[model samples]
Target: MLEEEYQPRRELPPHLRKAPAPEAPFSYELRDAVLADMPAVREIYNYYVANSTVTFDEDRKSLREWKSKFTYLQKLGMPFIVAEAPSGQLLGYALVSPWKQKRAYRFTVENSIYLGPAATGKGLGRVLLGELIDRSKAAGLKEMIAVIADQGAESSVALHEKFGFTEVGRMGRVGYKFERWLGTVMLQRSLK
Candidate 1:
């Protein structure tokens, strides 16, 4: 796990934090996520965990925990990237990791994505996912899948469809939060 004291400075400009308008191009660059991205990544993720159903966990995670997660992904040789604006502010990030630890499941991986609040509805998620899929395919993964919260919107479903992923299954009431239950949806895209 990465140390809690780890805080890598993003080597980009500073004006990128401006609130995005309806049509500012929503420009972003897809690049490998470095140690410097942990703070922004943690901010985006914690917001979701606390206010949205994107993930099932209830307790808010600490920076140390996020660092450990990044460390784990690095150790697994997984592909992780941050979507950044011209000034280096992070828009979002995506990654592919093993779906299961069993050797039989090594050929398959699951996908995850999180975008900054201001960056939503700007199409950055789609671009980030496209880059991630290309990298995963080039890495020789046989299949890539997404496990999304059942209550997720059509945009998410459509994004996967645009990339050739189709609904594989759904688990009812698999997650409980905000005083309610939510379903889990699984979708997959084949690289082979």
Candidate 2:
């Protein structure tokens, strides 16, 4: 055996390598978000904002804005969960927020979920959303909503269907991005 061939490999540079998407068994536990989770949460959320229609914003959010979001969730007593691997890394996050600002809209909320690049298509998203629904119902919310970008074209819609959400409305050319307009679809799942 050549001595040089026995050495362990070091981390490869981005251009020369690929990383595996994180996956675990279909089951994952959810916990309340904590201050310590801000960095990982910011990283995962910004990744989607930068690379996909899962989030519509063109610009990544600052840490201060992240903190403000966290504060809003806290004030609403909404569930903000960080899904974790058995080894304890933050795999993804799911959250619920006020569907509309009016007092009449207080009983409804919108849910959002995002996974790290390496964590997609592994069934983790479904688990996080299921948990979020349970939390919303427990909080006495009447309906859970999903507003999906037309270009999203992924499980964001399918997952909602699996949970019994029905398409309630659609808007044509409601969003402009990437030099074009995109439609929007809204789905709602009744909790009562």
Candidate 3:
């Protein structure tokens, strides 16, 4: 065998090395969602549905579906809110819908909070959830439930717990998504 020649590894020059990205200024205002906001809301939700197990939905939701939901929530006097940037771009959304269709379950609702990819890890979720809870209380809702996916949703579970939501139950392997079994952790909080 021929003898190998020695080679020296070269390091990139300081200016050539990649620098950390500068954080952009993030400011948003929370307000009640309007009919025009469904498209943006659908895009945000579809991102999770198509890419992560955080949502168990295997198919993307249509704009019509989102609009229908908005109408239903509006008719029920439920809280459906969005966070918008100064530039009028939607940052995220949070809502509470009836937990069950029965008349006896009218006082209870299930809460859902979804943030844009760029909006996570900046305490936006905390702000959104805080406002959601306050609005729910103002709407005379008595209880709020959170059904969180056990996989790829640890942050969601933690966020809910931080807001005084207690784990009421857990179901294992009850959902099949992404070619794998998934489970859910149910948490509940009293708005009263």
Candidate 4:
């Protein structure tokens, strides 16, 4: 091997290193999601599906699938909302779906929240979740559940806990994604 190839990589001196670019100021409003927002919502979700363990879905979802989900939530009178920038860009989304199809489970729902990469860590999740809880309560939902991945999703766990969700149970090695076995942590909160 050449000497250049054998040499270890060198780090830049602190003074010579480039600083990270400052994030642009951001703001958004939350509203009920429309059919038109499916494309943007799909994009945000597919990003996590393709790049992270946040979601166990390995295949990218199609627009048709998103549209179907939107319609299903609509028919069920579930809360499906989005955060939009002043310029009409979707920053994130939150929704609740029936936790189970059994009649006994009608009053319980599973919550899902996803944010665009640039929209995370800016308090958007807190706002979205807070509003989702309020809407679910208004809709007569009595229980909300969050199924979060055990790996690569610590922030999600913390966020749910902040909203008073408590660990109900856990399933180990229930998912296989990205060449690894994954597990889930279940958290529950009461609306009543």
**Highest TM-score: which candidate?**
3
Global CA lDDT computed for model 1: 0.87
lDDT of 2 by residue, 1-192 (tens): 699779786877888887778864555568998877888899998887777766778898888888888998888888899987777778999999999899999999999898977778888888889989998889888899899997766578888999999999998887776777888889999998
| Steric overlap count per candidate | 0, 2, 0, 0
User: Which ranges in model 4 have alpha carbons more than 4 Å from their true place?
Assistant: 1-24
Ranking the candidates on TM-score from highest down gives 3, 4, 1, 2
Q: lDDT (CA) for every model shown?
A: 0.87, 0.85, 0.95, 0.97
Q: Given candidate 4, what's the lDDT at residue 76?
A: 90
- Model 4 has an lDDT value of 0.97
Q: Per-residue lDDT tens digits of candidate 3, residues 1-192?
A: 334665567889999999989978889999999999999999999999999998889999999999999999999999999999999999999999999999999999999999999888999999999999999999999999999999889999999999999999999999999899999999999998
- Give candidate 3's error at residue 109 in angstroms: 0.4
lDDT of 4 by residue, 78-177 (tens): 9999999999999999999999999999999999999999899999999999999999999989999999999999999999999999999999999999
TM-score of the candidate numbered 4?
0.87
Off by over 4 Å in 2: 1-28
**Candidate 4's error at 55, in angstroms?**
0.8
RMSD in angstroms, candidate 2? Answer: 8.4
lDDT measured at residue 97 in model 3 versus the true structure, 0 to 100:
93
Q: Sort by lDDT, best first: what order? A: 4, 3, 1, 2
Task: Identify the superior model by TM-score, candidate 2 or candidate 3.
Answer: 3
lDDT score at residue 12, model 2, on the 0-100 scale:
79
